[model samples]
Target: MEALEKSREHVIGLFRVVVGLLFACHGAATLFGVLGGPQGAKPDVAAWPGWWAAVVQLLGGALVLCGLATRAAALLCSGSMAYAYFVEHQPEALFPLQNGGEAAAMFCWSFLLIAALGPGRWTLPSLARLRRRPGTRPITRTSSTSSL
Candidate 1:
């Protein structure tokens, strides 16, 4: 059981590393206009400006990938998706048929899971052993006048 747990932890830690890198890529795309916009995808409206939207998505992705603020990042991403869904995708309906917000939905779910389970053991946060400390109590000897 312990072995199983260790393997699971390592797997999740690796998962976070991959996720973080991916998020960084997406963030860079938005920040630097690699994919499309100078600020990534932006809803066409008088809504929030494209620059702020890009920052929100990019930052959330980074946090999720880092596992430093998993829940918070996940919530932000999820909320972004939800807002996008209603504001954009809902009018058109589901995906494939319209490519409607499905990708965003998946992103939401992935981050949500990450938020719940976290990056697992072997992560930088847990690897230091700083929180648990080194050892327990020490044994001491008593000086008695008895011979054995």
Candidate 2:
């Protein structure tokens, strides 16, 4: 059981890393026009939403990828993707298939899950710092506390 739990944690960590890297890749593609991106269409960087979303993608993706403030970064990324899907893609068609918003929807949900699950044990600068410190001995429940 312990080994299985450990394996699960490791897999979650791998998932986090993979997802973070891929999200960051999207940011890189859009921001720098690299990785076969920009698709011959360049969004106006000085504009309002376009540049703002790109900045969030790049910065948030990087932060999530590095496991720093993973939950917050993932949440922000998720919101950005949600906005992209609704504002840019959803109006084009009713369904994702016709609207071309599959990626956006997927990214939004993925980042939401990441935010919910947190950094999953392998993250650097773990959020554990915000929690109570570990005690030298394992905590055990006592009968006296049962009344509470």
Candidate 3:
């Protein structure tokens, strides 16, 4: 069981890193038109949506890779993809694959895992700090009443 748990951690860590980098790549491409992105796309400026996408992709992806905000990033990006697929690209399924729902389903599942599991113990939250709190209760000893 312990070994299996450790394996799961390793795999999840890799997933965060890989997915984060890829998302960041997309964000960067969309925002700055860097590395030959869409021509004259004029990335949406309202709410700096493009920039936000870039930041979220770059920073969030990094956090996921480092297991810092794996769950948070996952949940956020998952929703983004959902909106894109259903709202924006709703006319048909992904470009290929017989108009199937494969990619959308995969995205949901991946992000769900992130939200459900959160960044594992290896994250930056400092577990030691979690163990100690200001309002901890004191232990009490019971015996014959006072005067024993």
Candidate 4:
């Protein structure tokens, strides 16, 4: 049962990391125009909403990825996606299919889930262990020299 619980936590953590990575990629594409954007031309840093959203995505995604302030970062990311869906896509049509807002909707929900559930037990191993008693040593197996 404990193993199963740990497995579930690891899976959730992996999901969070992957989502953060994808979100960060979107920011990189828009901010740096590296992955694919406007033929390699970066978005204007002074732009109103687009630039601001990208900055949030980049920074928030990183925090989520590292499991640091995961809840707050996920909340911000979720809000940004919600804003994108409503402001940029909702006016086009009633459904996401017609509005071309599938990604936004998905990201919004994903980040919301992360915010609610948290980083889980699989948060970066070293950092997680740092919370343990200062003088405590991690347990490890050792080979027996004498016959059992």
Candidate 5:
């Protein structure tokens, strides 16, 4: 239990990285027609909802992955997914299983969790701060005369 508690931050960091990567990949597929391409026809440039959603996914995921403005990015991502689920999926069916909205629902909840929990230990800004900390100086040697 203690070990699990100690590793919680690392686990959260890993979770954030994975979720961000997956979301980014989804956006890349939709926008650039890569990674197996979009599930359907690619949206026209500056198209409604679809194009804008893709943009948010790409930018927000990148920010969350880097742990820069993670909470805000995650919140945006969550909202987007929630919109996707409700607007695109729920009309077809009341439940995710029936409507094929599992991915959207999952992403929405995952991002919400990330927003609440934070970016954990592996944030880029935190690493930069660590590097710039005042006390972590390099060792130095001084010459001294010795008498026996």
Candidate 6:
């Protein structure tokens, strides 16, 4: 229990990175037809919900991955996934098991969790702060001190 508690933040950070990476990959695949190509024909540029949804997924995922504006980005991602589930999948079936909405539901819940928990220690902003802290010098190849 003590070990788990101590590593909670690290676990959350790993979760956030993975979720963000997967979300970004999903968006990229949909938008660019890469990574085994889009589910169907790629949506036309500026197309309705499809294009917009992909945009949100890519941008929001990137933001969350970098832990920049994580709360807002995670919230947006969660909302988008919820919308995808309810509007796109729920209409076909009452539950995710039969609706092919498991991914949507999972992503929605995962992002919601991230939004509530916040970004953990590993983040771009945190790294920048560490670098800029007093008495800390920016690392360089020629620098004698390797610590930091």
TM-score of each: 0.64, 0.76, 0.61, 0.79, 0.88, 0.89
lDDT assessment of candidate 1: 0.64
- Candidate 6 vs. true structure, TM-score: 0.89
lDDT of 3 by residue, 72-107 (tens): 778887776676556544567555254454555565
Cα displacement (angstroms), candidate 5, residue 63, comes to: 0.7
Clashes of 6: 0
Ranking by TM-score: 6, 5, 4, 2, 1, 3
User: Candidate 6: which stretches are off by over 4 Å?
Assistant: 136-148
TM-score, cand. 1: 0.64
- The 10-residue segment with the lowest total lDDT in model 1: 37-46
Residues 85-117 of candidate 4 have per-residue lDDT tens digits of 999999999899999999999999999999999
Say what the RMSD of model 4 is.
Answer: 9.1
For model 3, the superposed segments whose C-alpha errors exceed 4 Å read 1-5, 35-42, 47-55, 93-105, 121-148
Count of residue pairs whose backbone atoms collide, per candidate = 1, 0, 0, 0, 0, 0
**Model 3: lDDT to the true structure:** 0.63
Query: Which of candidates 1 and 2 reaches a greater TM-score?
Result: 2
In angstroms, how far off is 92's CA in candidate 2?
1.3
Compute the lDDT of residue 59 as modeled in candidate 3.
64
lDDT pick, better of 2 and 5 = 5
**Top TM-score prediction, candidate number:** 6
Q: Which 10 consecutive residues of model 4 have the lowest summed lDDT?
A: 34-43
Better of 2 and 5 by TM-score: 5
Model 6, 1-148: lDDT tens per residue? 9999999999999999999999998899999888987777789999989999999988999999999999999999999999999999999999999999999999999999999999987899888887687987867776476678
Best by lDDT: 5
Model 1 misplaced regions, further than 4 Å? 1-6, 35-49, 95-97, 127-148
Candidate 4 wrongly placed segments (more than 4 Å): 1-6, 38-42, 125-148
Q: Candidate 3's error at 117, in angstroms?
A: 2.4
Per-residue alpha-carbon lDDT of model 1 for 34-59, expressed as tens digits? Answer: 76544335444334645555566777
lDDT of each: 0.64, 0.81, 0.63, 0.86, 0.95, 0.93
Q: After superposition, how far is residue 102 of candidate 3 from its true place, in Å?
A: 6.0
RMSD of each: 9.8, 10.3, 9.6, 9.1, 7.5, 6.5
